[model samples]
Target: MSGIQYLVCLWILLITQSRFVRSDIQFIEKHEGDSVVFPCAIEQRNPAPFGVYLKRSWLVPNEILFMHTGEDFKMKYDHDKSRTIVSGDPINHTLNVTISELTTKDTDRYYCEFIVENPSSEDEHIPGKTEFFLLVTADTPASVDSGRIETCSGGSVVLPCLPAEEGLAVEGVSLKRQKGQEPVEVLYDSRRHHGNEPPSYSQFPAERFRLTSALGPGGITYNLTLQQLQPEDSALYSCQLLQRDRPDSHASLGRRALFVSVKGDDCSCSSSSTLLYALSSAVVVLLLTIVFVGICLCKLRPSVKPNRQAPIYEDMAGFKDLKSSTKLAPNHLEDTVSVYNNTSVKKSCPENHYESPTGALCPRNETQT
Candidate 1:
């Protein structure tokens, strides 16, 4: 081949051999004393790959945590050897590194690299790589005394933002919410300004979050109000007070933390109240039913009317023959005479013997004697 054609052919070969691929960044968040696993996938190749490496890439000199060579695995750092484990599965084409008992110092960006020997050149080429960022947060003593608020969905609630230490001049306030894996900035208000300049205010969602301040005897009280709450709004809210250290500098004066719990609209208390109302209505209905039944029974029953007329003695002589009857004779005779003389019965018996001048017991007895 000619010298120029050989140079062109070699250039084409190098261009075809060297290739690069970049993946999107992944972010992870965790608490202190927790464990995390970084799973890296091995690129499939015809021959078994040469080696793998896990390193912290954000530092000036990349720190290698784990390395895999031909049939062997090792940890480079002595401090990490106790808490880190590196393993790989050749068949599944995966390399996994796990770190336990993590601390805030372990928070950094990491990358996994897979190297393969290039047959054409002496150098090794990275065929596969992945990167991720991890964040670890530690709990402070003040978090133990954080305030907690609970509210229902679609309702509004206010989170108080008072200085931890009193009598400090606060120039600004910032509120943040920590949900699952990220801390979101809710709002910020700057109270400091130059002459004739207005204060500054900013918020993530202006419609949902509002920051209001009130002047009181103690100092200015800043409150953050959340409207139309949802389940996702339940989170740990942090408030920081900013004070002007100098004309061009500001520092945090104090921090206060609050946790909020948002429930569904049909909360337990509302359900209980509804149940109690239903029971009360049922009781009232039952009482009304009983009263109605009693009234029906009273109206439906048959009534008895007194006769009002005295019963006349059929055998006056028989009554006089008995000794016990003699004592009742006067009252009985007076009752009989009063009944016989009644205007209502006088028409039927116009002249009764009890009312006769001859004093005969009865007309039939007088005729017989």
Candidate 2:
């Protein structure tokens, strides 16, 4: 076969495989910090399938989460060991896997395959395969609208937790501090214990956190007092209350969150410096605008050029006579004559020629010579 024929066959195979994969894919959406369960069913056979494989699909390589062979099961990844569980029932021909505490980073596609022995030959084949696309969205913090408090460093502040219903008896209370993506549990107070165990809160310092109960207008309020506050203490604090009547209910009875801001000693100075910087920027911008306008006006103004042409004498007749006389006696005069100025013309001309009021040289009427 030619190379062209091989290329065409490969392209057709890829398109066919892509369509088959798309048909088998299932999409699931959940919020962050939630749990998800995936169920896989296998074909009923005389002997159960040899093994099962659960993998997280990627562009180049796939991550193997669970691998089962006969009656043995193994979890391949250490990070998911505590959060992932896989169980299979040969009699029911079913496989189930559960993952808890999911984050946005866990959003990806997964593949589940069942391996079986081929009846005709001594080879293993995949009898069934399934694909899942898990989408984990960011979960917004709960109860941020309760209240906010601001305090300076080295001071103490109180965060209030109010009950959701007016008269429900509170069973347990927990406080968590949300800084970045994760919430750190600061305190947990369990009034009564049920079948399930409460969440642990051993990571934070016990001396710095205190949970106290107080009677207010509301039935009861739980206040979390944080002592010796530092700048790092500024964060969103969430309070959760579990009521005694709802032991089976997994949801909290009420959730309240408060924002706290711990300022440093130089906070005021920093704010003043920022204000001064803004004012300086405004002044600079105003000055630049004024200079630009002045430049534009100067360019647009009309230029007044000096009058280079000689000034015109008021008396044209006398000027004409003077010019004619000068032309007639050009060879007699050694010095250049000034016709416009009366004093200059008098020095060169006869005494009978006097200046008129209009500054024109005129000769008085001469008697009979």
Candidate 3:
């Protein structure tokens, strides 16, 4: 029995030493028409993140105005069922956000938290905290600017939600639905508005909306997965914060406007690609012009000769002949080194020699013949 108890205790110690930890995230700041990356990571090996939560609220002007999670949509007046959704890839562990037509009331501090189940704990799980900040502002539409655009119908956009404070640790992010609709019936979802282009414009896009707390790095996130994009999904979207007891007033978190610009069939297709196309064309034209000029010069060049002597090729035999001719010069020809004697002493041609005043032998047979 004692040995059995010791084994159990040893087993417990081993388990304690190998405890598994949950995931975390890195926060980022992004405005409308811009881009942001919400990080979510796991400390344990292959710990499955089945669910995530994210929440946003008004900060300065009015606190806790409105909010949303992946589920539940509520406003002061009624339930808004078609405006929010979560659009991140759990497998890739990235939380991408986008805010369509922003309004002034969407400015506020955002929060996010992730939960993990601890099998060994009494509660069967532990709620892990996620830290992040959100600053929802009104900016230009990214679909039209240098921004990378994505199309979605219904509720399928990862809106970048900004929290009032940065890095505030929280247990779990809640998705509270809010009600805020346009009484005038905004123009965005309409089949007729689609025009003759491949992309159609439709009015009355989403049927409802909701919000939730994300695992890490929080901000405005998605709630609905749009089946398809329609002309109705073209208008601006507002991410309002939910209050503590009574959600913030629609007037509290000012609205942000995002002008829905489409890739119409006539947004200037003549220019096709970017300015790089023109630059490449210009380079090709310049090279061709240079080649043509070179060809013309080569064909029109005039013939001419260089004012210099050509090279001479000789060997020892040629050198010997030159030397003999120079030495055997005729008597009348002063081709050799001039002998400057003061007295003309006519000496006899003794054999093949001529005696001079200096008593030097001369090649008389070879010269003066």
Candidate 4:
């Protein structure tokens, strides 16, 4: 046989085999924290072994859920491994997934893919995909609308989750804290044998969390009253409906969260803006006080008085007397020495000299000497 002929025969056989396989979708309706299963089937005439891959998607494809070779089945997304269960064999050509502890974020489309590698072919693996859409309904009626609730410390507030559905009897409800992707801290359960609290709620304030049944527009509304609200009481609270017969069934009707920004009563921490304002005011007052004290000190300080000067005429008279006294001292010594030596002396005074009242050298005579 020729090589071209063998390739043509293989191509025809693969085309014929691909026509026999088909994928199908299954629908599911569940509530939060309830386990739900999805079934996918692939039927073919040839029961040859194939690989299987499962993935979940919202608007875009997300994490891989399960992957199967001919012998082993492995969970591709390890974080969600504990919650996902996959079963069925290649011979059965079916895949079933049971997802436990569902949340609102889990509502998405799941894809079951069957892949086959053609014999002796290095090309891309042939894939066939089946899609399943999951619809998770809230346990409460759709009309009840409440989001985040804010309250102050030492005050009382109500977190209401009213079911608007008129005919459905209220079997039970579970109130819990939504811990990220799952629920944590069971606050209340109507189905529990010991009132509404579980053993996990021993540390929780039993008296502060009260259940109130009242009549509203939808007839009877259930509210969880929170008293003595502190900052620590802030969290996302979930109100889930429980089935009487199937006590394991948990679904959220609505969520009411608390944002406790209390003013006082142990919540004494002030806002950042208030702290900034106080610090700024203190700084301004300190600067102003310093300036005022400096001004007062300057005003109260003693002044330095300068020494007074003599009158101009008195100063001139004193200068003239100082000169005359200095000159007369020398002249008197000279006259004494002349008399002792017995010298015949001429008049010591110049011919044109005159004495003024101050007795200083006058340069020339005012009157004749």
lDDT of 1 by residue, 1-369 (tens): 854455456555544543322444566656688899988776677555566777775422375554545465677767677888777743345778899998767766677766666688773545245666665667643342345566888777887776655676777766777544445655566766633435655554678877788998877888878888886676667766555663421222125555666767555566565566566557655666676788789999999897775445636545644644454456455434355556433222233334552334434435345
**lDDT over C-alpha atoms for residue 188 of model 1:** 63
State the lDDT at 215 in candidate 1: 90
Q: Candidate 2 residues 1-369, lDDT tens each? A: 754455456545544543223215566656688998877766687666666767765321365554555454566767677888777743346788888999866665576766666789774544244566665546555423434576777778877765555677877766676554456666666766534555434345777767788776745778778878887777667776666675433322235556566768865555655566566557655666676788789999999998786556646766977876666464336434567665454333342233443223434335412
**Model 1 error, position 77 (Å):** 27
Q: What TM-score number comes out for model 1? A: 0.37
Candidate 4 residue pairs that clash: 32-251, 139-253, 140-253
* Candidate 1: Cα lDDT at 196: 47
**CA lDDT, every model vs. true structure:** 0.61, 0.61, 0.37, 0.56
Better of 3 and 4 by TM-score: 4
Question: Top TM-score: which candidate number?
Answer: 1
lDDT of 2: 0.61
Q: Report how far residue 296 has shifted in candidate 3, in Å.
A: 28
RMSD of candidates 1 onward, in order:
28.0, 21.5, 25.6, 25.8
For candidate 4, write residues 1-369 as lDDT tens digits. 654455456545554643333344445546677888767566573634366666675433675654555565677667777888777764466767788988667755577666655567652333344666554444544432334454667777776654424466665556655423444645645544534535234235787777778776857777777688665555456564444444433333344433222335422333443465556557655666676788789999999998998899999878876776676766556534356668666344532224443334535345445
Q: What does the lDDT come to for candidate 3? A: 0.37
What is the Å distance of residue 82 in model 4 from its true position?
1.0
Candidate 3 error regions (>4 Å):
1-157, 160-233, 239-257, 266-272, 275-310, 314-321, 330-369
